[model samples]
Target chain A: MSIRARIDALFPRLASEQQFPTQGQTIFVDLERQEVRRAWIPHRVVTQLLGGRGVNMFLLHNLLDEALEPIHPEVPLIFGTGILTSMVPSASRGNVTSWSPESRVLMDSNAGDYFPSFMKLNGIDHLVLYGKAPKWTLLHFEGDQPKFVDAAPFMGLDNIDLRAKIANDFSGVEGKDYGLAAITTAGENLVLCSGIMAGPKAIYARGGPGAKMGALNLKAVLIQGRSADLSTARPHKLRNRDVAVKLLNTSVVKNALKKRGTPFLYKPSRMLGAMGTKNNQETTWTDKLDAENIDPYRPGMEGCFACPVNCRPLNDMSVLGESGVGSRESETPAVDHVAATPDTRQPTPIPDKYVKGDGPEYVTLGKFGPNVGITEVTQVLRLNNICNDLGLDTASTGSAISWAMELYQRGMITREQTQIDLEWGNYETIERLLFMTAKREGFGDVIADSSQAVATGKYPRESLDYLMAVKGLTQSDPHDARILKAFALGLAVATRGMDHLRNRVTLEINAKINDSPDFKAELYGGPVSAEPNSYEGKETAVRRCENIYAVGDSVGMCRFTTKLFNSPSLPGYEEFADQVANVTGIELTNEAIDHIGLNVMGVERLINAKLGITRADDTLPKRWFEEAIGVGPYKGEKIDRGEFDKMLSRFYAISNLTEEGVPKPEWREELEGVLTA
Target chain B: MLQTESRVTVRLPEPLREGRGDVITMNATSLGDIIAELDLADDRDELFNFAVNGDLVLHGEKDVALKYGDEVEIVVAFAGG
Candidate 1:
């Protein structure tokens, strides 16, 4: 098809004011029947839901049947691009939505880079799959035409090798490069904690979407298309430059991200007495994992497509041991310190050549480092690399391992149950457990689904109190929330369980914002919203943070590029509306945008309600309230139950939900109208 | 009036280092005094969250008194990841 013909075919309902397709066509695939279908994203839905995560939630709420199992053939698996995707800078996000096989709740995992943009270039906004393939299959779209090929040869390959092999095979095919969303050996083996590898550094690395894809017998989704031509979008030169300049000048972007990537946050986190240490029994540890110490391991930095802030670090594997700076030859003694046993495990050979990969983000660093009692930066990097290549969610994997280690420390779990001695900071044992978990081998099956799975029936009732999880999903944020009321509340009530990407009020730490009471009231509905430890105004803060984050996720904007992450000068709700107007000629007031965010939350609640989640599930783990933080400047800090309950009630009232945390019937009916229309 | 001689080591974030190393020694009785001594007390509330010997001292608690050889870390509020 000609380019114009293809565009017309894909976006039949394209609006006149739109210089380019804003919300492109939806492609539905029936893997069982090998059938393909297409439809335009209705204008009404676009206006209300605003595509990406919002539209994904809308579609899933209307189409998904809760009776079906998470990996059932009839269950819908959806991938969608945000409305602003490919039309603006740092807006390359694509969302993968489905019922999580791990968390057993509605899950939306998002990432950025070439994949979403490539999907748009091929004239697709959302791709929904139903039913299962007969065998392991690769779904390849060659310039908007779909093909199914045998994927037998690609099975069991690690993520890096898998991408390389596919690229090598498709190297000279009409000189077109392919965009891949693939899984590795972990997913192929149906590991419950596996994630979908989207790009070099972007992974849909939560909620086990990879296992769902594996269950569908879908090995990979590949898109081959011509490079995107920027002229059609008619991007404003001065506005783009202005945004670029603002980002470049931001102190956090310049000093923290541009210097050492996300891992730089590790020191601050430790200093705040917030970093979760030794399975959260403490909040600080050895300073060996400090950002300055890890400087030599970082070769350079990179960024997502069109993102000026290159927050991703390229870690050099060559600088990990005896040959590198700050090498700890004495620390590598082949003996288990806790068990006092000779370490019989053989060391994996380091590559002689210089090797590099993206990672050791703050979450991964903390989860693998202090939380598990492994203070060595090299060990954390090694574990992170293994997870990336094996298609495992690093946060969940680290949480599970740490929980087991704590159990072992208490003499609750013996070597007989674990088969291997579960000692704190034993890198070899941790490594072995990771492999075993990915393959679901032997005792690995007991804990592969995360600590929630391990606690139920397998462990004693008291053990349930110690598993730091909400609604089956383990907490991903490394910062201890007990001292920070806002963070604590956010973790308790986030839609996708304990993950911070959902609704964290990160600005609570900024003492300067507290001085501007007017701004605080406008954003968070109260004058005193910025205090971290205060119960006053916390409910409003959490509610407002969730709403704005909903807008960010829906518009395909990175949280790092917005006020949601750090910089106050970046785009907020008002600026976002302006951006939408500039890109698509869609004039929406900031209030309307905020309403859209509220509607997104409503739709998500409806979906979760169907899955039997309610106010009871919106609570912190027992440990947060029962046990005070044993160490830290914030010693004796614990969540006050009465205060937390009052906060929840206030949040529910503001969200137009009932005291039970369910959306009222009228709001639900209104949201249902948006979904069905 | 008798005066207390308080000596402490202060650690600052990269940007706030200002050609000085990450760690610097100062003699001050309180966090406010330290901030003033370092010439950082002017309109820099957002840039700091002070901690003395790993204990958090909030904006309201800047009057938190210091002692001899206390290690103070000027923790930045914004942790980007």
Candidate 2:
């Protein structure tokens, strides 16, 4: 078959439907040459590498001709969706793919928002960009046709203002008619912590994709209009989505999310005495920062597109609405707003203009709450509000700030260098630093860089002691690795640097309730080989979770609902295969699904190898091994290096990679052949 | 299959309340007793970790002895946000 013919065949759709199942026409635009060429990814690519991060990896590997920085003009910026996104439940995911200016590796960041469904509904599943814009531009999509409008007016605007100005321009169209992605000034300044915003809330908030867009001088991708010729799909595949919907309706655990938001993490982690506080140095906190504390402010429960579970807490942060700099069009907005904003909400004395807020999820709570020693729930909301406006990633920003706070306490970074009398848990100082960091002013400029770079520049060698990072990225998920052994292992081996989204072992030595041999065999497909504290069976558990998560990311499904081992009713690899087969007319058995995941994994390993990542990089931070958690039930707890090595070796063996974390020649050859694009 | 005549106040988070109320007075001595008393026995998903006065009952049944007025917080287990 011809490449286009193969691409057509891969996405099987309903004959009754007039549109392509993959949605959107494929086109490549070179900004420098001002050329827009029609292009299509042979469906063979999706079959070989799957979609989302997997497909992104394969395409980027083949496209890059020379070793250029992520912000280099020659690099391509790619946006992709999974085969199942907008076709199935909770698949409201859109991914941005590029070499990360932060980690300097080909990376993809996924966000759940209205924007992705707009792409799917509009038939623009895959969009690619090249060269640098001669002038700032906004790529507006009406179906597949894009008009590159001058974006000079939108330049230097915060994420919220950019979204609002554009949304207001098209306000007559209604809220659901369009989806937009834009950047803040931080991205324009090339701040390593910057991210791409989708809608006013959801963010592709990791790996500095914003910096790449900023370098392109591309302001936005505004997608509007439905596919006049809608993509068709086999009704049988879509009918299978009922399985997920029914499961969602009946599941008991899904209710927890609906009721409490991600704040559910607070109660359990606190009960185990394993919550993050004052960075990783402490993992316990006072009861005031508990998940339940948000009760007064949490008004409504919201959800992503097509999802039944409304897991996000809609907070009436109107008090905080005026607290942001987004309201002002030009110049620094916060210094004025900070003084002008006032609190009408009483009891806790939270200051105003930062309200009408959306989230203070677990990461926000942990990072801004316990991690920084602020027990006040409202202050965390302030942090969330600030980060959301300035286009900063809450996880990394929190980690970076907390890491610095730890340094200051130990007398490593004094006030002379920091320009603030930095102290642990000082909410006022913490809030001040957030503004400065976002603006890249004063000491904030030093911190806007990677924590490792900051440590190298400002602190002594011993200062690396408490920096909980892997592969130069700060640890975002606030879990202390010493307590959640498998999570720690996931951070080390995951393709993304220091991320837990790739894999999480729900059952582990730490949570050893499922230790029976029969039960282990039933769930894990193996014998009860190791205890929670032992290194024996952890590798098997982590590898299994990673592949399932890999498939979830590729399909654009939410992993919280799909692969959760904590639940009695998680959709497994078999279910994933069934959905893929039903939706795309691709018949994938359980083995094929596993193979696809492995194929994706192998490609990432190859890419990382090409980027010079090694087995040593596939290791945890010194904090996990050297410093025992100072407080908590798991006090004086640290990972055993010997045990960690055993687990790492097991992981390498499973991935078909060498001990040095590089894919073996045969493995590379197999992946290379799979990259038929 | 032990005699259960003890009384305990089991506090349920909103998700598990079945629209009754957050606080429930049930006859229970052990974790199994609480599960059975709530009539959650047949549908017992073991969905939560039992905590008595902020410490987890690592062992499920009767691991931590219940006392009068001791607040039991049922926490749902999750990996990340």
Candidate 3:
């Protein structure tokens, strides 16, 4: 049978009666042809893939030509909603999938509440954008027909402004709903770090989707629907209201996410010594935390559709500057790092006053702050805002900029070539480069090429020595390989280059707080210090973490809430499977759920393997072994290369991979079948 | 001759809050000596320099002497992203 026929057959055989309407809509738009094609994705396939992110990944893997570079224009841009999206209380998530320009691998971002509701109400469970538009066009999905409208006037607005205009344009149009995901000038410019914003606060902010759109000259696609059938009430009634209520009333879910937003990882991460400091330095801050503005307790806590815990803090920024822009609050460890620096812009007898805002989330703060040698919070925020407006990925942009600064300071690069005088804590020069990079003007163009490209003999390779990135993706935070051995190994081997979010094995070493201390100690060995240095059981911890994270991503839930709030251990595998079965009405098992998670991870691995990724690409920088932190708790310590190799060997052993850490052909076969068919 | 020892005050982590009652007081002739006297072995290496009377202590061949009523603060490097 053909691939499509096989996919069609698997649907009814696998799905429950109520999981999907027999005739649910699938809309495909050909921008070149300016034609719309509609079909039905049977309920079985949706149930097997678990809808939304899971389904999107499966489809993209099958349809895309091969493991093409993430930035290739031929790769399909998929916008999909999950089984839980329109109905379940906590099911407001939409998944966007494409080959990532930043990581150079398949990248996906989940936007909550807005995208899912809008897509579902428009009678589309999946919307695929393939081929480039001849001109800038708006994709309007109303009822069963998809229309193409000119989007010239709405081209250059920022997220806030674009959302307002789109709302007004579609206000009285029959059958549409609230929320829009639109690209900004950053996308139009095709900067590799751009993103798309959905609604006001929800953003698909990673891996350069905006740049991809810019390359295609496809401005924006607005998804809106007013079909009351898209209401949350539908899925709630199907799953039995008790299940939805139980999820909301779970106290464990509420308390954990309230205070820190996602940076709650700070305390445990600090203890493990994984927290990035002074650009991955050995020291940690020891002082009383500012208690007044802890995030969760702050007013106007907001959450996704049905979630009880509103983890996002609302900051009334009327107090900040004349812009009167109030920001939704979040925190990152970089805030303190940046805050510690003295502002260079101030005159003699410099005033202590500085700009402060919600966060320097871990990724941006780490790269812009310690990584760049500027510890001033105001400077970090300025850099953060500049990158955001320019549509740059803060992590990659900051790491690249900081690497350039370090290279200049070390005499590796000439001042004439850099244009700006580079120095640590020099905000003026850094600010100028941020603008230049966004415009890809002069020296900024060189910086925009990323550290990997620079390392290719464009500059002295010695300068790339200090750059802490892998596979083109810079490390989100500095982690000592000697300390968190498992996380180190995981980072080295992660398919999407060096990333913390893809595989967080560090949690296993620091699992005590997630569970009871006594139990974790017994499982891993003696009570490991909050530090990630102890090698004992590090491999096992990392393996478990990778599997759980993979499952969370495939299921279309945010990893923060899934791992932290709703732990895999909370309801056991069987109970978790039952929850899926109850929600999608597909009788699944603990083993089957595991298979699905492993399948998603395996497909990603296959893509990388086809691209010839191997143990060579999995290595950390040589500087990690040679350089020692100048001061603090681990001042003299360096990661032992021998220990890292041993850890990798053990990790491969546990994961059923070869000595080179490659998954076996049998493993690939199992996963490929699920993804392709 | 009347004898007196130089004093340094150290802030404690929250868990150690009860014992210090605010800031712990210690006595020695210099910043290094005062930190050693506290018996805080784990935190001993963290003190990079001292802030005496709100000014940073600078590197010099001769150790600076502390005087009565002079406020001394020791700064330690801590981890954050």
Candidate 4:
């Protein structure tokens, strides 16, 4: 028999018990009742939707009430781990899904760290929270029993302090014995731009899930499982070492990532003339904010569970000479690494201000640095640590500040409203705004809802025009997308609004790869797709990448571990299929995996369609079409309205959606079968 | 003769600037020639892209003839979000 035939023969029955690789149980938390229960996840749900964002989409579609507000007690918040989440390398991701308080649409946010893995190991593959709690509550899952604790003491604390307090009050070591997902005062205050801190540094920062958690009065969800015997606990074997070797050997970018973390992308973005400066009024900036400039303050690196890339850079508060946000209670920073010596050298004296945190990732750096017109790398790092401590989404916060600065420049707002001079690159004002927004103070409360929300009747129509948002969520990744048509198309059609992680085709910028017409034709459907400026084949590229990214998210694999984002050499459909087979003992062809991804998109579309999304909603911000890059190599680059419309139409066609941008009857029917199965 | 007389001003990112400095005044006829002259450890074809006079030069445009005083930027080929 053929290898495929043999594999199929081995799992021909697909016993219902084998469907769920992790405990196969979904924890149902009823906050209003202050009760918790467990249910077996249907085998059909596992087989059809896979897991993580895919299953989250299914749950959202079934449980969501279209008539109610996003924060309504009836609206459910679902958390899911991917089918392969803890079984493979770089597969340490989880998804939290709900109606977005920020965008007023279905929102699914993902984060990578030990939290997801720990949740699975503690016998929870899925969690669904229903109803609002009577008061602040903590859901604790230890062993098999799930219980609720009065979280009154944990309320109002930042994530940094929350974790420290949890350790003090709870029983168990943080990472080894347990893992947590918590919110800070930002979430507690229901700051629409707030995010949930996953473990120490990773965050589910998009779509206002943090605010939703706050609205539900859920302070934290802690899972405890110290000694999970993997040999008996899980059926699949972990191919971590083998996968790590394959990743490092195949992807050239992994080495650079290992060395400098994500800050390494700064130089390349600057070189492309795509780095957005001054709220994208300019596309380039001075080299003072470059990666090398930021290197001095980067003390070390960190990574998600089982991920070899370790792409998270550590910001050294000692080097930057500012005490980090959470270290306010004591003289020396509370972090352990800041005190430890590197190499044989004596440890440098802990500066008067000392703290340690992960990243100022590239997206954080760009949004906080040039996009807001801040040039100092130290200032950017400071802002990053502050945002991390406060549980604020750095991208949206920076965009909010930048939009205000532009409004200030245009004389739309004054000092009477803002209190502080909203000048470009005003470090003090920018820093102060983050604190205020987290606390919901004064003008900060206005901008905290999002740049789009601030522009109701309060600001002029031109102020709304200056707002760089799509579908209400402000733009992340400060790269000027107009220069790359595929990326531009992605921003318009992303399910979660103006986020780049949805469908950024980084391959568009790689010139050498674009040289091969055959490769372009095979991957993106036409030779013209290789050209960054060309609109002809861009729709196809975006459609393909959207599917790839959807699949990556569904599987809990980081985009960095796949060819979708940067490394063309990393795993794609064929490799993912192999991993799935090894993990589940179920055979899934590359085409079947691709269909699963397409179906995942269909479910998301159904939810959005229920929320009333039209073709008009799938579009770029007006600024992208009206203004060209004012300076840099990409000067004069702007999206042509006619071409963009054509691209949108083509994208809809390729995605099996109507010109209205909603999934067609046939596609919806097909998805319905999988969802109901 | 004009190609030899042409003095292209080439700008380099920090990694390539070691020993050679940040900017270089080089006598090269084309983008490929300038790349060939640089002391690079990685394959120039795969590792870098070039820009002339502040415009990104695409794949097929590398052979575009260079003129005197043209400013060239050597960009490392990388992408991320």
Candidate 5:
């Protein structure tokens, strides 16, 4: 039998006494052709690949003819959720994927909120959007059938307004009746940093997949499914369901999440000096961004669909700013502006109390604050809200603006070219620049396109290093590799580029909090050190973390939960595999689940490998390698080039790849069925 | 287990105070020893993540030696993407 046939044969029958939804189907919509088709994903493929990101990538790799230009109308964009999504214990995540306009590479982003569960409830596991909509279009699913409505009326509206409008159109519906995923005018204009916003403050905001959606003229997607919730299948799995339930019910993280939300990170991150200051010229700061400082403005906290860990904190900056009437804690920023007026010259000063949303997550906090030299938490909240309204990836947007400020300070760009004084920590210029970037106006246009902004032809060679990006994605998860070797390695080698979540070594990071060399040794399967800067055995730890996280992400669980990568004592294979068995009615061993993770990452690596990604791409920016971090305990620390190369080779080995970072031929050959399917 | 002889000073974050004063005393020698003795309720023992003077006893260290100084700073440890 062919390798594909053998793989399929292994999963021919459910590996349990109970049964699963083996007939999950795909909804294929051709926007350009204005047609739709439905097909069932073979049961074996579903079982082997699992779902969410893994399944989406599996289908996308097979369906593509060639790599489309990032904004090409024919780019296949997959919006998908997994088998156990919204089942319980923080599993309400969905993933979106396409060729990233930002990095010009294979792209995928995951978000936790309302959309994933609805997709599952609607019996729609995946939506492979093909071709382009001839006009502005809305894909609305009320039941099993989807209605393609004209999005003209909602065109040019920000994500929040557009979603509210769509929700209003489906009035008198139950509270859980529907969820929306939308793009703003930035997306409409094909801005590289545009992101799709879902739920309240939940955004799939990476890699400019939103631009792909807008390029197809697709606007809002309002989704609702009428099936019973996943509770129907919750009684089948053996062992530890009660223990899992108990952990979810009484976890301190969940309790703290209910109270402080993510805002709790504000002080600790700063205190540890694990922060990016002034675009990484410094990695620590003394500023007014502590939890005590911002608590008065915090009204409440929220959780995503079915999540008991209500960890999203609401930041009410409107109380401190222009206090607009619509600045209610739950509102998505502005209500005064419905459809955007297209005159770019008119600057919209952030109105009093204009910012009302949840979370100044460490991402937004790090990128917008000390990284860009803005210390005021109030402005960071407003900036975060503006990014939401304008449909910007806060990471990319903040990095781009910070990149520009560094150039301005160094006199790389004259005031004549900028038409404004580009100074660090200047809120006025920063605020105006944000609006302009969304509108793609003037200096904002230059700043918005960061890759173009720093191309050697446009600037000096030194400027490229200062951009603080790896593989074209800018940095700021507040992790500094100069002090944290694993962080540096992760930034260099993460498939998504410069992100900590993908493969960040979290297991040993907390070792310094007390001193658990024994547990650290157990986790690493070798003698382990508590030092963050130690290069010894970091690759093995990173690889282990990558595999665990890969499994968790594919299965639609949040990293912050009691799943794979949070605290060590939370649920791991025993609970997660059991939960899957209960929900899908297919028994899974711990090893089987781990194999799925390894298989999924191998597939993802090959997809990028086909894009010519290699060890050359698996590297940190020039600054991390050449410049020593200015402050913190490991001051003047930098990743030695030889050390990094050794780390990369070890990581590649762990991932079962060539030294160049390509998947071995056997793994690629195994995917021959998927490639040709 | 609160041995008055070898008692080490403990400094807890506000959320982990759990009715104990900010600066309390622990008789245990390691974070795990002290943590294992605390209640398994939502807020009490669950938040014993790290110790300042203990060098580095991070999540699930279960046993890392702690020494008495001015205080061994302990913080509520959590991580996110």
Candidate 6:
């Protein structure tokens, strides 16, 4: 049957009281028309897509114009719920999409729990918002209608307070649970680095979606549904839910993430000299590892929604307060310490009592710590809290700060002229600057615009050469490019600029080998191991990983669990295709799924191209090639431009791009065809 | 003839214990010679700044003579911001 016919048939059947189950209901609000419309997306489609990430991406690519810049007001903002969100057991991952302010590219960030399942119960496969609301308005979905309520009271509220207020207001609602995904003061102010917060702790914090929303004057998107029919799937469909539960409960998938979160992987990465430190100047910080209390292994495990793998850590902040340490996560403290304490002779010991909380993930630490040279645990916490409250992305904030510090160090700006004293390890100046950047105060205002912009006149253009970013997004995880060429290439070509999440080639390669002879061969370049330093098969490896990630994102599944758990084989695809076939009744093939991934990537590339991005935006910081650290596994090593160029050529070849690295006209035509059709 | 060997006591951070054996002792004519003999990774060097007795050693000028029982501390540099 045609997709349109299938959807038409299912919508009526699911919407009608006779055929519709009691657990679900449809609520529709048309803001522009000031009318209410309602419909249901079949449970079959939800099951097939496996919820949030997968379904959302599919809708987004279809709804938004691929050629438009990610930040354009015309770009659509999509909120989607996953198949197993509330019903099946495991972490519940919610997905959001927008043009990323940080990367200046297309991107999405995930939130945990309530939001996904709650939306699903309301009979929404996805919430698609296009164009800007005329004014600040609160979108409230209840029963079969969406109420456009006044949002003036909630306007300007920070994420934490906003969530508290929403929960308080909706406290009386029973099984009809709800959650708020809103922007903070920084986002409302349209700060370039702002992010959207979901609930108290979970945040869709990357890519500056908050800033995008603020620009459009979108106050908050509140998803609340009381329909009990959401859990009432058909008896036969219950079998699929059981399969999902078994898959999640199985030992293989949950063990890895549960052990030490994803941060544990850093041990091997560090040993291989692939860990990032101080904006990629140093690959490892062995001594600081203990002082900064950067442990891959820790106690307590938390998760999102029905996800069984509890990867989030519940941190203790009491010790941190006692030690005069404001922040107690892993990365921020490390970044602050390394950047501030440049001269090693007076090695300062971070007080053990000050170590508070759990993660400063690899990216957070790399950006916040060595990158900007401040080492106080308190200072990192302050920065983290400030960023959260201000609605700025911690990664971008750290990157920008590091860039400013380097510019100052290089004589690009005098200490007095820069306004803030950027001496390494000084908490006072760093603290002042964090708020300043959020408020666009003084030099902070100029720096918050972007590293590229700051590097323009604040520092000599040559000094900008040291920034390790692609487009405007800073590179996360300080792995040496020479050691992990595939990762470097992936970062360079990432759709949302330089990020580790989008194309995790390094982790994928590591997982594939898995303590076997095969692993050795891949790493060492022999039957035993492939040489990590060699770029020989890196392009192919990166391309495969990128494609898989894109597919996962478009399918609306959590990459953390889905990609890692179902490696080598994507178990859910057949079911996923079946679900799409049943709902839209479009017989989607595995090949079609692959096509969606590629198509999304192509669209992302088009978006960048429209923004006038070229090969220049794909390059890394020049310091990686020029500065050779005096010690460590990579002591004498540095990236050579010629070799990088060769690698880029190979990468372009795999993507079927022209020699100059532009997507081939034929490929573009093919993508355009798919889009139009 | 062996010049007076510096009795440098290297303190290992708790986290690095797994990588390097808990404690190591080495003899060298100068601090540079000791560093060369130890064959530590560059990341380790970035982590700790060496102090002889209580004075900081400047890079490149490795001529500080090591005397018997001369205390050397390998202090780990903190990076938390």
By DockQ, who's the top model here?
Answer: 1
Write candidate 3's Cα lDDT for A279-371 as tens digits: 454434322122222332234556655554565544332243312111111121111222322333332212222222334344565566556
What TM-score does structure 2 among the candidates reach?
0.89
Strongest candidate by lDDT: 4
- Interface root-mean-square deviation for each candidate? 3.1, 4.0, 14.2, 3.7, 5.5, 14.9
CA deviation > 4 Å runs, candidate 6: A1-72, A81-91, A172-176, A226-256, A265-272, A286-299, A319-359, A376-382, A455-463, A478-480, A508-529, A564-592, A656-670, B1-81
Task: Tell me the fnat of candidate 2.
Answer: 0.34
lDDT for each residue of candidate 2 in A1-677, tens digit (9 for 90 to 100): 32223323433321223222553444566766666655445555667656766777766666653366667866777787776777677777868877777777656788877777777777666666777889989888776678888888888788666777887776633227887888888777767777888756678877777778888888788888776344445564455566566557543346567777777677677766778778777777877777787777788887777777777786665544333222111122233224434432333334454665778778778888888887667667767877787888888788878888888898888888887767877666666676677667887776677554443475677766677777766776787778666677888998768887777776552122443456555565455353444466667777777887788777777766765445536666766677676666667777778777777777877777777788898888886788787754556778989888988998888778888977788877777876642
Docking class of 4: acceptable
Candidate 4, DockQ to 2 decimals? 0.35
Candidates' C-alpha lDDT = 0.74, 0.69, 0.54, 0.75, 0.68, 0.55
Worst 10 residues of 6 chain A by lDDT: A337-346
Off by over 4 Å in 4: A1-18, A226-239, A250-252, A320-355, A452-462, B1-27, B34-47, B52-58, B67-73
Candidate 5 residues lying further than 4 Å off, grouped into runs, are A1-19, A172-175, A228-246, A249-252, A318-353, A455-462, A512-514, A524-527, A562-564, A674-677, B1-11, B21-73
Ranking by DockQ: 1, 2, 4, 5, 3, 6
Q: What share of the true interface contacts does candidate 5 keep?
A: 0.21
Residue-wise C-alpha lDDT for candidate 4, range A447-524, written one tens digit per residue? 777754553455666677888888888888888888889889999999988888888877777666676668666776
- Model 6 chain B: worst 10 consecutive residues (lDDT sum): B40-49
Candidate 4, lDDT over the whole model: 0.75
Among the numbered candidates, top TM-score falls to 1
> Mind listing the fnat for each candidate?
0.30, 0.34, 0.02, 0.32, 0.21, 0.00
lDDT value, candidate 5, whole model: 0.68
lDDT of 1 by residue, B17-69 (tens): 88999998877788878768776653422446677887666444456788887
lDDT ranking, best first: 4, 1, 2, 5, 6, 3
Off by over 4 Å in 2: A1-20, A23-25, A171-175, A236-241, A250-253, A318-352, A455-462, A507-517, A528-531, A565-568, B1-9, B18-30, B39-46, B57-71
- What tier of docking accuracy does candidate 1 attain? acceptable
Every model's DockQ: 0.42, 0.36, 0.05, 0.35, 0.21, 0.03
Q: Listing candidates in order, what is each one's chain A TM-score?
A: 0.91, 0.90, 0.80, 0.91, 0.89, 0.78
Candidate 4 colliding pairs: none
Docking class of 2: acceptable
Backbone clashes for every candidate come to 0, 23, 28, 0, 19, 83
